[model samples]
Target: MSDKPLQRALGTTYRAEMSCGDLGKAIRQAATGPTPGEHTLREARVMQASLTAVGKEIEQQQEPTIAQELRTPVAAALADYAQDTGEILNAVNDAYIDHEDDGAWQDGKTVRMSAPLDELIDVLRALSQSPDAYADLRAAHVRQCAVGLAAVPSRAAGPTYTAPGRNCAAGLGYYDGIAEDIPDSQSKQWRSDVLQRLRNSMGTPPAYSTDPAQHITASWQRDAVRQVKVGGSGFLTDDSTRILDIWATARGDDLDARKLDALQEDMGSDACSRAEETTKQLACTREPSKCP
Candidate 1:
């Protein structure tokens, strides 16, 4: 109860076997008051060590998923913002008995961290209390800085939102209309970067969904076209849209193996020699195993 807000939150958190006795026990006993001559500094030290250990372990954990990797840039930006805040808060805490009460800049420092600083702290605070934060936490801290658009007065009054599920990935946002906006939203750009990274490390998954709308690299839209040979074929005639003299079905998700199979079957048995690797790869991405 006596520690600062961040510290209090840290103290109240449960531990399996902290360096201190059970954290809850130490907190309760310390709060009942230390003996008149005895100092309970040991309890404070143990609490600091335990919190540091938790945070350090979380930081050192490897990122094994694309979703986790995507968070790296945002985390780095927030950390830099927090570091800018460090000297100011340290001065206040070391000098003022009631540091949290004061929000003004420190004596020798000109750059006060302000709300940007609070963004990182708030995220850490949330993580400490989150049930899944330690085990499976993947956060996106997107700072969409709006620049040229700000000059358009009509845009100022409305809230700009992405389609649903885009912003649903536990992303925390901080935006500035002019000073902080980065001009381009970079959402698409970031998605491309992240996808390339994922693709290089792990190729398109065998079960990768076939919905182009949901894909980052349009993986589902890639269906290989194979030319079938017909020798004096029957009524299996090629029907192009007549717009182009090309004889092919549409070039979208519908161009799967079933469509190809039916097309060849309708052409009669001698129309196509058995499919060969030289002539064509698999009709779908998974069979090819490496999509363009």
Candidate 2:
């Protein structure tokens, strides 16, 4: 035999025998990239929508399982945060409306609203600084301002009312002016912060072989628990069957009674039979006293 071929064969064997630890380390290093936080705001927005959907699903379930229960608090928190954001937006709108229509403040006449704009600005500033507060307020502020502006008559000159001079127009202008400066980054940051808080509330998914593998494992584990609860001869209860049906529909799996029965029969026959055979072989090979 040629020594070169033998050397090559030996090299291949050596490579195969190398420790999996080094291979794993190399793979991880290669696969590692930017964190989810680094994703674009638009991408984060899409992710937020998906998270919201999952949250809604958990909320709608009549009786939550352990996993659902764990997710519920986080979802509720996010929902509450969203509501707070709306309240803040409404405050901003109210402040703008109150200031905009003031007769004392002239647009270009170096006049200001009668009510204190400073206080509103302070609240906005505070909200921007606090992640929790911002999460509760940002969306609401934007939405309220946008909708309120849309509903109000435009400051254009028309038959019903004459447009004010530049000075008066300037006061009205404050509402639109203040709103335009809200940074996209701030909005994105608030969203990111809320999502992070929600994720923290619900413990991270277990580290498994891969993301998809982890999802599969979780799905199966949930299904298995449902099966046990529902199929137990003595302990089977209404709650158990409801859980099974809910999971089946949520997973998009058919839950026909006949199909479930067929699957149970197949699995029991194959798996139980194989297990029994293995047990019998082990028993037969062992010394009776030692086996006992």
Error of 1 at 109 (Å): 29
- Write the residue-wise lDDT of candidate 2 on 1-292 in tens digits: 1123222322333244434343223222221224411223222222233233332332344211113222223222222222222322223335435643231233353222222232223223322344443333322232232232222233322321211111112222222222222345564444355434323333233432244323332433343333423121221112123222333344343235564354334423433333343333323223334443
Score residue 154 of candidate 1 by CA lDDT: 21
Model 2: per-residue Cα lDDT at residue 163: 14
How many residue pairs collide in each prediction?
2, 13
* Cα lDDT computed for each candidate against the true fold: 0.25, 0.30
- Which 10 consecutive residues of model 2 have the lowest summed lDDT? 160-169
Q: What C-alpha lDDT does candidate 2 achieve relative to the native structure?
A: 0.30
TM per prediction: 0.19, 0.20
**Listing every candidate in turn, what is its Cα RMSD in Å to the true structure after a full C-alpha superposition?**
23.5, 30.4
What is the lDDT for 48 in model 1? 30
User: What is the lDDT, from 0 to 100, of the residue 248 in candidate 2?
Assistant: 33
How far in Å is the alpha carbon of 98 misplaced in model 1?
A: 17
